[model samples]
Target: MTTTQLAPISARAQFRPGLTPAGLVTVLLGAALPIIDFFIVNVALPTINADLHASTATLELVVAAYGIAYAVLLVVGGRLGDSFGRRRLFLTGLWLFTLTSLACGLAPTATTLVIARAAQGAASALLLPQVLSIIQATTSGEERSRALGLFGATGGLSTVVGQLAGGALVAADLFGTGWRPIFLVNVPIGLVVLVLARRLPESRAHNPLGVDRLGTVLLAVTLISLLLPLMEGRALGWPAWTIALLVVSPFAAAAFVHVERRMERQGGTPLLPPSVMRLPSVRSGLMVAVPFFAAFGSFMFVYAMTLQEGLHFGPLGAGGALTPMAVAYFTVSMLSSRLVARYGPKVVPVGGAIVVVGMVALLCTTLAAWPQVTILDLAPSMVAIGVGNGLAMTTLFRIVLSHVPTDLAGVGSGVMTTNQQTSLALGVAVLGSLYAGFSESLGTRDAFALVIGVVAVLAAIVTVTARRLPDPRV
Candidate 1:
């Protein structure tokens, strides 16, 4: 069944969730896993390195491979879900993610772990899109808004929690599991979410189509070219070919766009429908999601690395540093609808500016204290920034999906997540590059402070643009 043929719900109707409480919670629980997997590895990376002796470049590939593959394959994954039935794909993906998580935990070599991580990412690609699709097809209006809000809240909080959990798991080393606990922990959660998802619901576009091969291949290549070089470049010492590969990326991207447009015009149900881009909410929200994702990815990567290598923090200290921010993000996200309704997404970017200012102040403090400041000293900034992040992240999701027509929900969700995942990889690359280049002379702590502070400034600029959103309410 192609998406065009589906009639699960009308585009203009109101959201209703009275009949789907168990289903909604089931789906939301399902929603948390992919996000949890996304950032959960950041805190565990040092342990992975110490245990496996992975190079800096290999460690990056471990993270980037998952993100790059997940982004590239997500639209196709959505299409598959639409064609086969969303519930089926959701269940299957959950199982795959669960099994792959085990594989990642058991991987004894860096190469094996990278491969398993890619598979895990692919599983996430299959699992994530169907979530918003289920919500969109099944719910309407206020119900939809609240569901999206919860999804955003959990998603945002998961990134923070991943760090802390990763820290705790590695520190505990349950059953002598060591860092493996980070991935192994997913087994129970995935199984629980999986069993629940099977009973949740199964809905599909009445006539969903099979995957788009041309678009999928082109996108995968485009992302690989763009990401691998960025992630691996600095560690490889910025070779000439890395710059060449980057220059080659735009051409590949343009080709992917052209091919997708052609496919859509020919009624092929291309992975990313051209029409999805025409939505004002999606385009504008994406404008914000891209930079926001990058800023986030940079934060986890650089902070984790700097704390361990630069500040002499063990996994415990580094992870502990993130706890306050995580709490703030969770607390504030639950309040987004009230806030966005009263003030709109405009408040988020304003809040982002405030956060950036707070971040800058914190960085300045680090510089002044230079080699003397402890992680404890940075807790206030972390909490303040978390508050700012909650406002910004939740508002961005609401603003972007608000205008997405109900019929195109799957593709819309796919595009949004793809933008997020890709931009995250890119953000890590760019910020990592800046940090690597700066660290040579500025010293680790100072260089990290400079790089993150600069990225926060860039995030403030992106927020300025995001505030131009046409509609902030759903």
Candidate 2:
């Protein structure tokens, strides 16, 4: 290693590397929190229902409200981070999220808790995008890729950890808090993170600009129209209002795009820059990412339901069944930077197939072990899915950002995250709706397998999509 020679150092030059261990931990923690929350509640739903008297619709609402709102506001959040300071916004978001989590824990009624969860999700949107932007602006080359690999690991591991941790929390019922402990746990950790955030260096990638007030309103409306109904509709018995809103979703979505395009033409600040489409890597990566994420997203809910509803495992057992997956995901994801360096963009397509086969194999084992399964019995299948998913998910991330310019890193990241969030909602709606509709007739486990098989086909499509990604735009 070589060091730059300095004749004399100013007092301010002490500890000049901004991407210190503490800062990296801060960013990784921020990125992990929101993703973990998305899955953590799944295993605890039964406990929550018994304790809070929440109906199935309400439980689904609790999850959907957070996810939809986060998906909707994410790009705007990134844009705000760009205009304001990333550090300032990240700290404020962490504080808001911490407070909202406390509110979630304390709410006496299901309605209040759902509202609090939604607010927490919105806060998460504000906090998450800024983490990556800070790292991108703060590092280069090997350092950048390593940070990104850790980010991707956080994304996958969060899902596994959320389920496992939420289960343990509910099972432990620390100080007899029961289901409420899940939300309450975030409060203290969040406070500590926020305090540490104050000393973090402030960074911004763009000149300050007015918030795109109209675009924000339009985008929120579009997402609500599309997302709210799908999640709530089935439980509500597919009301006409749900259908009406869904039918109008395309137009609402169209209006948002039209408005954004007009703003770009007038040289106004758009929430998501239209120019990102000109970059082949960005566009193609999103194409593969959508279906791949759609599949990945549903598996958590589908498999949890399979274990609990189909096989009648308790919360600890249902959530614990995924422990092998978490271990497999972390172990294999650690290898991704090395794998990508060896194989280039080819890693994503190859890994996608491995993941599909692993899913199919897991489903087969699940079917074989029905009605008399233990977590240990599921270990072999779990290991397969875990290793395969670690490979695909970590590699998919590399494929998505393969050519992003450093300056546009935040928006590029926001776009990739938007695709992830949207596809997740889409998977739950479509695959979840399918499972709901068919499970009664086919039985829970069989119906889950059928729906997940359809999801697997979508993953295969993503593999094909990955093949087209290296083509540059004309």
lDDT accuracy of residue 258 in candidate 2: 88
Tell me the tens digit of each residue's lDDT in model 1 across 158-221. 7677768778888888887778988988999888887777676566665666688877888887
Q: List model 2 lDDT by residue over 1-474, tens digit each.
A: 000000111233223446766888887887777777777877877777777887555666676678767876777776677667778888988988889889988989989988998899889878876787677656667877887667766776776788788878878888878878788888888988887777777776445445677777877788778777877787788899999998888888888888888988998857656777557787778778778877876777677767776787767887789778878887888887788777777777777777777777777776787767778888877787777777777666566666767545555666666667777767776677677667877888789779778867886786677777662211
lDDT of each: 0.76, 0.73
Among these predictions, the greatest lDDT belongs to: 1
Error of 1 at 134 (Å): 3.7
Candidate 1, residue 347: how far the Cα is off, in Å:
1.7
- Alpha-carbon deviation at 46 in model 2, angstroms: 2.5
lDDT of 1: 0.76
RMSD of each predicted structure: 4.0, 5.5
Q: Can you tell me which runs of candidate 1 are displaced by over 4 Å?
A: 1-25, 135-153, 237-244
